[model samples]
Target: MTDLIPALRHLLTLAWQCDPRRLLRAAAMVAAGCLATPLIALCLKGLTTETLAGRGGSAVLLGLAAAALLVLELMMGHFAHLAYFELGDLGEVELQNRLVALAHGRPGLEDLDTPRFADTLALVRDDLPRTRASLEAALQLGGLAIQLGLTAVLLGLLDPWLLLLPLLGAVPVLAGNRAQRLLDTAKESAAPHQRLGRHLLDVATGHATAKEARLAGAAPFLLARHHREWQAGTRLLGRAHTRAAALRAGGQLCFALGYAAAIWLVVRQAQHGVSPLGDVILVITLAAQLSLQVGTAIQLLTVLQDAGRTAHRLDALKPLTPFHANKSDATSAPLVLTRGIRLEHVSFQYPGSTRRVLDDVTLDIPAGTALAVVGENGAGKSTLVKLLCGLYRPTGGRILVDGVDLAAADPADWQHRIATLFQDFARLELRLRDNTGIGDLDRIDDDAALSAALDAAEAAPVAAAVPGGLDGLIGRSYGDGVDLSGGQWQKLGLARALLRRDPLLLVLDEPASALDAAAEQTLFERFARLVADSRARTGAVSVLVSHRFSTVRMADLILVLEHGRLVQAGGHRELLDAGGLYAELYRLQARVYA
Candidate 1:
């Protein structure tokens, strides 16, 4: 409670950053509601004292005063609750957007792939909404604290000894706080089981994984695993809840005993003629209000504690500053690429791994160039491409664009000028148009441009087969939407990349891996023409990563990579004459076709 002001200040800052106007309104409502409760308590005490003492104040007037304050408290409490809920609902959308953006702003998938980060993200996703939706907690808490203070004043007026009653009532909440820690600890302790339970449930019931489960007749095993995990997590939670309930029950007993002791003292004072009859009445009213205040305070403290926990968890996540809306200008602003991209002694090693994925490699990709990157498995071809697209920053050396250091370039703008279609492309459950249109988000609704991109990707046929052309849903799980073959999906991926008409760099990793020879050739032909048009218009550079030597032969320049090193670089004929790694791999692939 000592650090309560600073902690709450930080939390309020987070909410205010989302929407200051709404926060202000919510806070005002809370204050109005909280003040009314204490006013009502004081008014009731005044009415009780006046009615009992037969003082100068009329009984009817005192009754009316208490009634009016009671009505005000009721109205303010209800309105405050409604306003708090509305405020949270309004902030939900903006807060969710901020969280998602923050996660994506991480530069690479490494952190996302780690179990610790994944768990934290999942919890944050769930906790943030719950915390935001609890505006009632804040208002209720304020009212409870204010009511407690008012009760203390009334008790002190009865007799200075009676003032100790409210303090004694606080024992239960202190015990409850310790009990609540057990619940929090239990949740963390059972996290592994909870995760396992969720994963097993997904495997058994999810549309994609369900097929394999049923086909392999492994449903029973999955069901059994799900049952076990659910039991494990539930058992721990149940135990914590039970223990907390017992402790709270004990605290209630203690409160009842203290209430009795308070009433006894007030009655004894009255019997000895040391206290008035009105003082006894006031003590009784204060004791009852004190109990309510303690309970309300406990409820409010629990909510605040939960929200504080959520904020702490989110704060612990790495690199949250990158996603702050105010910091978007320097890094997220668009970068202009005119001349080319140059890798000067570029290198990268995955965290916790000693092996460098890309060893000191220097390369130049001139504007209007078709560069082919050929390598065997684990030669770091994809890693290099990820670096170019700003998915990951290089651990060593630098990437220069038109003589400007890539590090100094606005990351978002730099990414905007590059588009990549990897071997494992995402299958977005969206309409056919959105599937491709998302690549050029600034003009996603441009019907004409979307059509042109589809044609360029040779995905016109894929669209024609669908019912609604651009609007038809393309994922099986989405309504009665039809699924595409791997080749069709490849074309869809290609269309997504081509949607960016003026991208300075285009990276295609195994673009036609699933297509037949003829289909591959046709897609490549369209791609070549698209590249020429883009190159002429914006000095575009395209990188092709493929195992097919036939496709590799078409690139203006070929760079052969082996074991994270560039072993060969030249035109296909020059590499063939040089008889290095490129020639060796190319001849081997050609022999298979022969």
Candidate 2:
């Protein structure tokens, strides 16, 4: 109960932020609805009394007045729904937008990988709108309160004993409060179960895991786990709901008995000539009307409690402030890395990991040069590329572009001047043009530039094969779409990287892993030609990571890493002559082909 107040306040704040006018209108309509309810009860009493008094014309006038009140009530109810719906829609949209922004602002994927965070995302995405509607219903509790107060006052004028009738209905409202608390506790306890279900669903449905599941025959194992989670969640929900229903039913019975007692007392008073027929009629009518109002209030309160549980999930996200760059550095023109890229004693390890991925590694690359990184698996090859692209920061050193430390450089500005094709590249389920255009969305529609990029990346064949050329859809899940082979997908990814207009550096991490030997050879030759063209156009540097020694041999400089440390750095022939780790590994790979 203590936590509920703050949560409700927060939801109200979010609602106001979405649209103040709509909220105000909804509130006004609800107030009007409350007045309409009392007006309806008054009209009912007047019509009954006038007909009993044998005043035919007066009864007719009272009937017409009651009909008018009914019409007004109906109108208010309709408009209230409209206003509430609008507010709910706006609030849901606002919450979703804020949640997306908050998720993206997380420092790294570490925060996103937590089960708690995942649960929060699932609830926010799936339950926010329902919660918003629940909140609106809860707000109508004020209208019910107004109607209850009005009914009590009118009944009191006839006889003070009738006031006790509404007090009897308060029993059920108190029981509802208890039920709400229990439901909230149950939901909070089941959060972990919900998260487990979400994890199972992700593993079952994810594209990357689909092939592995089939090959390993693991579908049944995963399905069993999913079913177990669902069963556990269902059991918890069932117990909570059953308990709440029992309490509510008991309270409702007590209220009903109290109402019957009140009516019997009114009848006894009329029999003794202490109260008139009209007065007895008024008392009975007010009691029933007020009882229904209290019932509605209780139900609305329950809904509000349920919505509050879901709102807490969305409230977990924290906001991030914009990054600050050093003011001492002057803002350069569009291009900045004119001289070279340099890493000075950089060291980094992933979160919660003891082993370092990159340890005091240092290197430099002049503008227009091709640097190749070669190493066996687990040698920090991909980690280096991530750091270079500013996706992750070094724990202990600085990366400099043109002598300016990247930490002090604006991240957005640095990203604008770089392009990367990671090994785990995104296969966006969008149009062919959008897949490539995402590399540089600003100039993606430029046909001449697009054509040039496609040609240079050896992607022209795949593009021509697409049904509608660049405009064709590219995913199997959608209509009229075609899926590409692994090698063809790699070429499309290369085309994406090549489409960048002002990239000062290009990082390719095992870019040809999917291609066959002959296709890789031809692709590398075209890649070299494109690099030369790109360098001539914008003086961009290229950093390639590969296990193939033949590919690194074509680079201006080759770097060999062992156990997170740089073991050898030189041109390929120089490293070969030195007979170090690079030379031994190169010969080992060379023998595979021989």
| Per-model C-alpha RMSD | 4.4, 4.0
Total clashes for model 2: 0
Could you tell me every candidate's TM-score relative to the true structure?
Answer: 0.83, 0.84
Writing each residue's lDDT as its tens digit, candidate 2 over 171-212 gives 998888898888777776677787788788778878768788
Cα error, residue 280 of model 2, in Å, equals 4.4
Model 1 over residues 213-307: C-alpha lDDT tens digits? 99999999998989999899899999999999898889878988989999999899889998767667667766777777788767766777666
Backbone clash pairs for candidate 2 read none
Displacement of the residue 28 alpha carbon in candidate 2, Å = 4.3
Each model's total of backbone clashes: 2, 0
Query: lDDT, candidate 2, residue 294?
Result: 72
